[model samples]
Target: MELNNEVIINNLVKRFDEIVAVNEVSLEVPAGSIFGLLGPNGAGKSTTLRLLCTLLRPDSGTASVAGHDILEEPVNVRECTGVLPEEGSHTLYPSLTSYENLEYFAKLYDVPEEEAKKRIEDLLKFMDLWERRNDPAGELSTGNRQRLALCRALLHNPSVLLLDEPTSSLDPIAAKRVRELILKLAKQYGQTFFINSHNLAEVQRLCDYIAIIDEGKILLSGRTDELRRRLQSKQVFKLRVADNIETAKSIAEGLDFIFDVSIESDSLMLTILDPVSNNSVLIRKLLNANIAIIELAEEEMTLEDLYLQVIKEEEQ
Candidate 1:
């Protein structure tokens, strides 16, 4: 499949005092795709978004948003992108009603009055905040404020949306609704979403591409599924025998490439290195001892596992 590029970062760098907040980071976000940046706190995920949004001037290198250069054409870049910064809800004018808040941003973005009215009403109704549109932003609940901020972000209908923890502080239902909105907007309008989030499940569900960042460096980046498969350096598997489970376990434990072998009655849960090459050897050895292998399958790795494994390997 062909992929068109939306946001391009080239050796981007950012420093704060003695610390390098973003270090020579480079990644391409495909146009009209939901791209996620995953990392622990203080891991440069948010900083990367800030740099792309032109909120922070990079020490070196540059990025382009919707084809506008971050350094040379920041205004153009911002014009083509909408940003829901961290603490996004708090950025709204507390005294203003939700409708007024979006209206103010619409005027700032030069959105036509008629179009902004329709956009604001559509967003508020879709987010189930239509009834609360008249309520003061500060008087609304945190979740309501979050919904309002998202509406404001979308009021201009920019091509690229940069979100920092998009669903933070939302109830479960509210979070789900927000996820639905993101998916709909990305697929329906071809809006490219660049998100920094600690929510692994949300990322797994929403993002077609994801990058793992740690301490200002990208540990991995690719199509979400492809990235996980590439990072499957080692895999955990389960082995079972129709009979002679003990003998099978004994022989399996003696193999150097196999690890974390544990026996529970008829099943053996183990970690294997290079299962493609080593599983045949394992089966051969077990069968030589007259062990009947019933089942041998690898465990599926979850996003949480992928993140923790990458972070742990980085420490090593």
Candidate 2:
């Protein structure tokens, strides 16, 4: 494993009775990158996280975290990694005040009293929970409690963070706030985050690298931008015409570089083989045919589009 990789798994497998939860999974998360593990429910996303966090030993396979072997150095692996499981509040004490809950965990992590105080105050303020610092964690809203759980994970300042649905239950506003905080922390601390999420949009916004898993297997994994380009085999464009819609469609379809064309009201949507060089030629040909060009633009492929395409292909 390279030094720049914070986590590496090789053919990691986990089984419960006769069913396999995680089978032959392998991937490497680069240091300081926010990597997303995306899948539908019961797709082994959470199980993979548990195995990496050393909470559940893999039935077979080897992995490492921050240079410590998971099987040989479970203690060091746990110490170097922080986890916010699906039930974030389970790590908190409902009866204990937010401040007290964090303070208690800080002591367990052996963070010095002076440093813990400073770290606690800074984290509370950063998460915008300073005012609720003295209130019992159970009294805070769902979003606030999630923030508090995040603070607890960061109290010890571990090198890697394993977050399972960090913003699962929050409203849009609260979810956006959590996303901003994750970006800010990744930028400021260079922390490597391994996140398992069902929200494709959230993962698209916050993660630079992504992997799609299903049926205890990895379908694909790569840099987000690269995946978008490579997975979308065709480029789609929208071209609006002032007149002669039928004529414009005919011209576009006749072009060798154009693969597909669809007419919509006064516009033509063309799927071209080479959008970068063929667009200008397409417009020139249409204008020459006496079709007035109103507008031309390329459509970007979204994560949702990619996800659906990959999943549908796998099913077929």
Candidate 3:
């Protein structure tokens, strides 16, 4: 693999008896970029992550992480990557204090005593867990525990992080904090992050690149903005008119730039090719026909909409 590529999967496949958990999957994640793997429940997301992490070998095909082949150099792959599995707290010790838990893992990762202490202290403070550093991890709230697990993953300062639902257990406020931390780390340390999430909004907000998978097959993959643009061909505008709603709808439908028009009571919803330039023409036509415009606003395309559209397209 090239140095610029942090992860590369070539026709990777994994199976259990008759069930193919992952099939002919291939992808590339650039170094220092945040990439998200999005899919529905039981879509082989976790299985794919396991293959990349070297915890489960692929039945066919190959993959590499941080320039180390997962099959041939599992040890090097492990050394260069940190993983926070879906059940993140499974790696934590219930009997150990939050600080002690991190300390122990730092030692296991071969971090020097003094350096580990400094990193742990900084991480705890950053995650707002310093106040409860001495409390047993089991006593911490689910959100706090998740935060602790994240801190542990970063304790070694590995180059690549494989995170499965990193913010699943976090409250809105804590989840926002985690997102900020991930961005900061990625920018400052040039760390590459491979995230698996069912939260479409979260992935849209944090990931520069995204891949949508279903039934062990990739349906869509590209830069987040590019994918959104590719799926959105026309701009939708919602207009509330005071009078002559039928006239307004007719005017919109008659325009060359407007492709479709729908009427809902006193409102007119228009599908136009270019809202910036075509909206004025629509309003002028409405006014010429004695229609009173009350409100006009463009409906924004959301990640949820894009996700569903792609899935629906694939099904059809």
Best by TM-score: 3
User: Which pairs of residues collide in candidate 1?
Assistant: none
Candidate 1 on 92-114: residue-level lDDT in tens? 99999988998999999999999
Question: Comparing candidate 1 with candidate 2, which one achieves the higher lDDT?
Answer: 2
lDDT of 2: 0.88
Please state the error at residue 122 of candidate 1 in Å.
1.7
Q: Residue-wise lDDT of candidate 3 within 83-179, one digit each (tens)?
A: 9998897789989999999999999999999999999999898888999999999999888898899999989888999999888778898888888
Q: What lDDT score goes with residue 75 in model 1? A: 93
What are the runs in model 2 whose C-alpha is more than 4 Å off? 1-3, 232-304, 311-316
- Model 2 weakest lDDT span, ten residues long: 300-309
Candidate 2: give the clashing pairs.
none
Off by over 4 Å in 1: 231-258, 261-304, 311-316
**Residue 32, model 2: Cα distance from true site in angstroms:** 1.5
Candidate 3: regions farther than 4 A off: 1-3, 235-272, 287-294, 298-304, 311-316
Tell me how candidate 1 scores on lDDT: 0.87
TM-score of each: 0.80, 0.80, 0.84
- The candidate, 1 or 3, that scores higher on TM-score is 3
lDDT over C-alpha atoms for residue 278 of model 2: 74
Compared with the true structure, model 1 gives a TM-score of: 0.80
lDDT of 2 at 181: 94
